[model samples]
Target: MDTLCFHDGNITDLIESRTLDVRYDINHNLQMHSSLIRRLSQERELEGHLGCVNAVAWNSKGSLLISGSDDTRINIWSYSSRELLHSIETGHSANIFCTKFVPETSDELVVSGAGDAEVRLFNLSRLKGRGPEENAISPSGVFQCHSKRVKKLAVEVGNPNVVWSASEDGTLRQHDFREGASCPPGGSSRQECRNVLLDLRCGAKKSLADPPKQSLALKSCDISSTRPHLLLVGGSDAFARLYDRRMLPPLSSCRKKLSPPPCVNYFCPMHLSDHGRSSLHLTHVTFSPNGEEVLLSYSGEHVYLMDVNHAGGSAMQYTSADASKVMSFAPIVNGVELQSSASSGFPSGSLKSNVAATLDKCRKLVQIAEKSLKEGTNYFHGIEACNEVLDGHGRLIGPMLMHECLCIRAALLLKRKWKNDAHMAIRDCHRARRIDSSSFRALYLLSEALSQVSSMIFIVIGYLAIYDWQHDAKMTY
Candidate 1:
């Protein structure tokens, strides 16, 4: 049943297909992400690169190979024929770092980045009758965003219009070509990037006199194939970083002021043990196709595999200080505050932690809140922790955390069943709704609170009739 081929873009057709009965969608997704790296036995050598090959990528089907090299050339190779299909000059005066075929373009579109800091796009569909004009291998699009060498290019599987780049300039940026697609050809309307995803240099600007120990150069990056929002970044540091892109500040505000680092956790084996003195640096980091495991390649060390949960251990959760700069918690990353790893990825371990440990104050209060909630004995500490965040950060506290606290407090108020407690829960629910209007939990809890108050019994009955009863049981707080 899993062997069935459902139409890619037509979800409705897939749902109506025979594969739907056997959970083909889920199984197929899982099969695509298996982290297992089978030992390499097959070798097929096709040489064309004059200088060393810095980056290579396969098309969506893994049929053809694309190689970018220091020779300032891009080569396309046919696996079966063992022939160099195309050897085009990239027009890059410096070394090339990465190149990829834009997804869903039938392998006709290519994007590449080099040490020259330019992101160029080629529409291979242009190779209809003849090669591009001699020495005029003009790109279809050109983007100059990073001031320093661009190290990596990441394109999401389903989104072909957008491209991501990490640079030695200490910035992670995004380029969306969807808007540029409409512009007329060869005019001044060239596609360029201005979207700053994570600007590590923002914090370093104020401390220019006292330079950072690490160069802050981002070496490699990969978007989680399973969880699209999770971005894995490895740089010139011992620690490999994991970021929930949603926690970063909006582009507008980030440009106006210094935005706190959105690093959810650090993954480092040395940090967890007494090997803090080790000069660890990550060369690359990847999530298994399933996004269930993380693989970290150290500069001069062995590879280590980590379960996503334990890679960044649960002990290093972010505090209100880091929370205030952004709009929400990286809830997915909250599973572990500091996952232990042999070489790469996640939370408050060792060297990376030393750089921004100033946010440590917010951790203890949260731990107390968690302990209190787990004991089921007292809601005081939990509620107090929320209040402290609200009081300390006020409007700056992330709305996601605010919503979480409001719900938690409201749930606890309902459990107490004290006079006017139901009313208070309703108030919290209203507040949570204002922060995030679409929350089903808040809406459901509001109905439950209304059911408790004698005056709103009829209203509660109406809500009960309309709402789904599937989430009816237990106070989640």
Candidate 2:
């Protein structure tokens, strides 16, 4: 199979699958012209699991890549060689939901959360060897903290021992390293008292809520590099909240309002649907290497790139026009600024610089979307309007719109009696549209009900056709 690799914003090479792990030095020309920088082909075929890949992390040196699969296995690969480094098999008994590399560690360790309601830590230092034949190591320590599946994990940049994890159980906890213990402190130790960060669920019964509904669930989280004392979290609720780690009782209650940090200001996909569910499954959140920006990715097939600084005390800047729920994104370290101009039918220059202009455009589209839903006309038009804004400032608000558009379209189609088609369309449309819709997307899903009615109509039409044919045959006889 032929594969393309992107590096530093360039499509430098196209290689065959047999090449597995390969590296290339991308040139300025490639970076200037392409959206992707490097590509590699693999000789060995890798299997894809039922669910999408949730997280991919590179080792400290970027020589290795660790991918966490819903299939419950963490596959390690040589980034340059593309060879299977080692596979660590036992983190959770169920699907391994998320994985992250511990910053500044020579000995590679991965913390994983899964459906088993456990967060397991694996140590790779002793297992380092040349071939796949090397014995895989078991988890060095297991933290059975979360009452539900763990969804997000973050290791403080300079502090490996201080890690934060979020789970479906509606809780976030902080864990630190133990001086002499093999595992970190507050790690499953019988004596240690764990630090509880926040409980946003307000003690709702788990049975009343759905597990897959991450919009209500604490979907994802990340810690700030500049202010290590702050943590950011997002969930089924439409908003992302910021918390102060220094507060004496971390979980007692969040401060009424501590001007939100740079990353907390934007609207997320989870906020766009009325089902009280996020149309997109928010998978991961991270801060840029410079700590000047924040990156968010969602299952809605959209990715958001935003400036953290624009999140003024109360006003949040966001753009939904250009980003799509991206499987993964790595910053381009070297590349020419990709230019845009009004002549090309796109707003000129980088949309990253103009937050207000971008937000204005998105707000207009949102208004159109709301109107379309109320009137039940020009559903596609509403979607297209949203798309136009997404094309302009996708990095800021694309995911939210994409997911909302999907749910809205599905509802519309169902209303038209396009049952099977509506079902299929809902999946495809949601996969394509990535943006925030202020929770309107899920409410517009009346299309699903419409589809059921349409199905019955089709059945009646089919019976009439068969009866007419029989009557004609009898007359001829």
Candidate 3:
């Protein structure tokens, strides 16, 4: 899908088409289409870019299209007619890499990120429809956030006042439009324009021996539409980190004290070749519109579609391996780490005494199993202990903990190549989903199980065909 290309001025529309059961009216301009529409491409031309267009976005109403280019310019076009409506030279010193139309705003505002390590917001109220490029539309406000180039921008869906920017400086910073406007000209406000800041360096607090200048340059980031507060950041270090809004520091903290390091509650590594731990780069990270799947693009060469519900597993990695290649599924997180994060939302006092004790025992067993799996020592005993904990005390644990345990068991079964045991593992996955329908990791594991079953069926059919061919030759001879 990434190989899809468009000529200068052309826009691609993705639609799904299912015959017989569904119908859509083309006269409605493709908006009132049926749910069956899937990845069908339609093109429209809106040519005004003079250089390589770096970024493009459609407003909430689909009435306006905006593009940012290497020419240090932003162009607005009519979505229906392909006519150039307005062009504004962004007074930035570098090329623009990302742009977004801020949603939930009465005024049409566009936020852009560029090589200057700043995020700028441009107001488009006066120039909605076609006209001569009138008095230039100046940026309403500018956010001097990162020390390096800002690579991506994700607007808070319902909150027009907030915007998030990911940059090469190893940080994800939030820019609040309200703060930029709140400060008086002469006040001592350090966070006058900028908002919350998140540190993306993994384990910097624990790794005292590592160099202070280690590279954690970020390239892409996305906010989950399903969980708007959840943000995902990934890049050169190849670890995709997920942050919860509630875990972030308060706005006042930025003004009064040294900023605390951003806490990353969960992370999964990108499956990229490590040219000695410094070469892999994550080009893009986006959540599926429904927020169940995470699509990760790696250096323009590989696209990995992971089921976020599974907590820790790479479901599919689409590379140059084959046009329709299927990679084996592997779970990423173990029982201990997965459950610890998932269950963190609930308060400690809420659990009964027995329940708390059961949870503790489960955590200890998971830790032992994880160590055994890593060191290849006491492997069978660790697997047995995990199963024992699940059997004896699974019901005592919460939905999130159970989900994590099921994933660990399923992963262990996959490693052992136990076909019959995997059915039980699949059953456990379904049970975990039943426990919590909102669990993204559960859905991921279910999808992987289905895929693994499909692959086995294909292998069986191929083997049968080979056997039949040999039998026929023997009889003929």
Candidate 4:
């Protein structure tokens, strides 16, 4: 969380260590806890990539690390051994920009997007007996869809067969590999892949320069983990746009839906230059695991974590100012103690059910608060529940759980437009931070509340200064 860039130079891959909690499989009846740890303490670094690592991804179980680099190569590293398992030559003509493992499949398959305007799918199944010397492996399928560099690649959790790629060609193309692989050109033969589902170009006529040089090119795109239908996009236009995937279904549904329009639901400007819009591209726009917040990285020198519920409502910005080191981020996991409780390291009776019960109750309360706000009603019940967790007049809760409660309350208050009860929200955010400074969500909420308060003060001072200047001018007259 503190250091933006873990590796020197540009970070191509920034994935946190995500592991599957086996408790779900152990106890089918109980709901499994999938807590995400956003900031990772550097365990060790494995030097393998010869050039700038373009992208890094962990397999479904977080056992393997697959990384593609500007070196026109892909390296597969073993997570357990902390050693390079195999190095693959992708044979791409340009720098790799994005890479991801195909989830939900038993086969070891990986997909990579590159500057060559192509998405290459490789089969690493043959990596078992192969030694380090026999690491070379060719891609099983190569699809050349984009005319320019493919900047980002995303796959839907519900349907991993469907893949989305954002390109600098000013277009986002959805490709479905379920049909089959694309036939090789000329005398060669391979399975024919499905045609593009949708190719959307952001035709917003906002120019980055005085005289426009090219069309708006998308740099980053991510699908919300919680809300699969929500897609966040950002790019050369310096704006983060959120699109509803439901509206932009496959091409086959066009006739059925009769076309309601598929551009974007809402857009927030990243760079607001007083004179004119600065040409700072939105490098990244990613949703948190819960889909409640969005983390945005700008090309210039800033990172922002905003409550997705308040994207359009508030003028406040929670900017995490940093240099070029701000590129990738690991997802933050909430309720670490809850995760630890499920582990065998802790005794069975000391925790588990008691904490789980409390956490679940708090989660439901948070949901109730969200639901109330969405209905445009008072969230008294939700607020009361949050107070119970925080105040705990007679009840006793651990620091970790208490911190989580504060975060939930602060987020709810923030969504209600913290400016109305700015003091209360700020106090809660501060208290959360004080309880656990390591809580990124708490810190982020605090920054948001503080920014709003600062804006109000600045506005008041500006008015007062103007009044004083007017009086002085009148006296001189």
lDDT of 1 by residue, 1-477 (tens): 012222121233334322323545544533432222233455777777789999999987878889999998888887777777787787877999999988888888888889987778888766656542332467887767566888899988878788888887777777778746322211124523347787665332111122234346788888988888898887765556678988877652123324437476655442222123234556788888888777888766666666666424222222223323222322223333132212222233443342232123334444555566677767765666655544432333345656776777777677667655786687778667766666788988888898787554566567766564534543332
Candidate 3: residue 441 Cα off by (Å): 32
> In candidate 3, what are the lDDT values of residues 72-134, reduced to their tens digit?
788877778778877877777899999888888753788888998778888878565636456
TM-score of each: 0.52, 0.51, 0.53, 0.53
Name the weakest run of 10 consecutive residues (lDDT summed) in model 2: 1-10
Off by over 4 Å in 4: 1-41, 183-202, 205-214, 249-264, 267-275, 310-477
Residue-by-residue lDDT tens digits, candidate 2, 1-477: 012112111121222111222453234334443343224445575453445677777766788777787778777777676677776666467888778887777637777777776777777886765456564677766776566778888778777676677887677766565522132322244523344566554522122222222224677888887887667676655444455567525433222212212232444432232223224345566676656666766554456555566643122343332124211222222331122211212333443344444455566665666677679886666555544444333444444454554555455455443324454344434343222222344434534444564675687679879989999999999
Worst 10 residues of 4 by lDDT: 9-18
- Which predicted model would earn the best TM-score? 4
lDDT of 4 at 269: 34
Worst 10 contiguous positions by lDDT, candidate 1: 1-10
Alpha-carbon RMSD, candidate 2 = 15.9
What number of clashing residue pairs does each candidate have, in the order they appear?
20, 52, 10, 7
lDDT of 3 at 86: 79
